[model samples]
Target: MSSDRTASHLARNLAALRHARTLTQQELARAAAVPRSTIANLESGEGNPSLAVLVKVAGALSVPIDELLAAPRALVRHWPADAIAPRHKGRGVQVRDLVPEPVPDEMMELMDFEPGAVMGGTPHLPGTREFFTCLDGRVILMVAGDRYELAPGEVLAFPGNLPHSYQNADALQRARGVSVVVLAKAGV
Candidate 1:
């Protein structure tokens, strides 16, 4: 979406969420540590809130930041499964959960990498980006010949076109993570 559309959408959602919570403009302003005029301007669709301001608004609304910026659920497209393809013989790289269908230009997959599983170097398709978050055990993700270890709650996003792979650090525990691969629908 264009930045203008995004800003307007966020402004509307913020205004709706704020009103739904029965918060007055003054109340929201105090809670978010921003001026009342800022909230008013955002609600009036005359201003753009920075990410930091959005976070503050999220805190004020007691919701995740993404909740305030998501498109309407009905309008979100299904994520195609074909975009995610993994090569390996290890136990930790099993596909667990998919977001049902391809979500327009993006795909999300939850992969469970079994301990002792490792994938050797192989470059990803050009124009692709991989985003992973360590959900369980430590995982070693290699990108462009460099190794990086990730712990639970940690996230890594990089170009998929580079030679990349992931290794399970231990066999005693399961190494699980979520890999969100984003591919261009046409330009790619």
Candidate 2:
């Protein structure tokens, strides 16, 4: 998402989460160690909060930064393949969100990989988890320091907060998969 869009999402999520927790603007400001006006402005989606402010807010809310910042999606929506943009595109690798909006609890993406394609070193907020299901060819889903091999129709789930990677297992073919990222939430 563009920075403007992200800030808008942050504004919406911040207000919703704070209200859900029964926190007033002043209360959240105190908890986040920011000015009440800062909270107010953020809720209004009128300013670009610094990274420190964002971290403080996320910490005070007990949510991972990603969940707090992710663009909110409607509960029900649809996106045609051509209308959807790839989250990442590079030599031998492509990824697209399966849904229109990023959900607070989870998000899913579709990935395509050519032999030798590798997407690596990405990690979500602590306590997050991911499920990867191979839909075609073969792939390897690596979490932390372990590698899990997957064939078509195989599914693997693991902690996503740790460093993780995905790659085509075969050096001469292609692979495809769907990844479901589950964001940790309170009481879940």
Candidate 3:
């Protein structure tokens, strides 16, 4: 690719990856051991970064150098169910990431709670919000010291920064739900 095109790809990918990781320019610069101004300039597509700089940035972002210069991906992608691994929580809880990659400021997860199972919520940055919809069976959500009984088709919204947890209400049935978390924007 032409130098200009490569620079453009680098700028876009760098910004996207940084956002997905919830890192500010300053934080990324610190992690990459680069000057903060360099990060700013690169993201603005105004710098011809050295190979050393590229390597440092890629290492900090935990991505390959080629990913930094690769062309934008297609808008639509498919992730097979079996291809995604389920994260088992305490007891009989299973959580699966619905997206193949981390989305900027957002996350979607599929949750399954076997009978008598309980799972603690993972808190996010301040201002983050969580939405949970019980798709089948029943779930009892505990948030901010309050208990909520959710039946199938019921939805609950709460601040994700606060303490929360979910439990299967029934002792003999499995409960399934979807959780969507929207993270707070950096410096907001």
What overall lDDT goes with each candidate model? 0.76, 0.84, 0.92
Count of backbone clashes, every candidate in sequence? 12, 0, 0
Per-residue lDDT of model 3, residues 27-79, tens digit only: 99988999999999999999899999999999888788999989999646677
Q: State model 2's lDDT.
A: 0.84
TM-score (C-alpha, index-matched) for candidate 1:
0.49
RMSD of each: 12.3, 9.7, 4.7
> CA lDDT of 131 in candidate 2?
91
Residue 101's lDDT in candidate 1: 35
Candidate whose TM-score is highest: 3
Worst-scoring 10-residue span by lDDT in model 2: 72-81
Candidate 3 residue-pair clash tally: 0
Give the TM-score of each candidate: 0.49, 0.56, 0.65
Candidate 1 achieves a global lDDT of 0.76
The superposed Cα distance between candidate 3 and the true structure at residue 20, in angstroms, equals 11
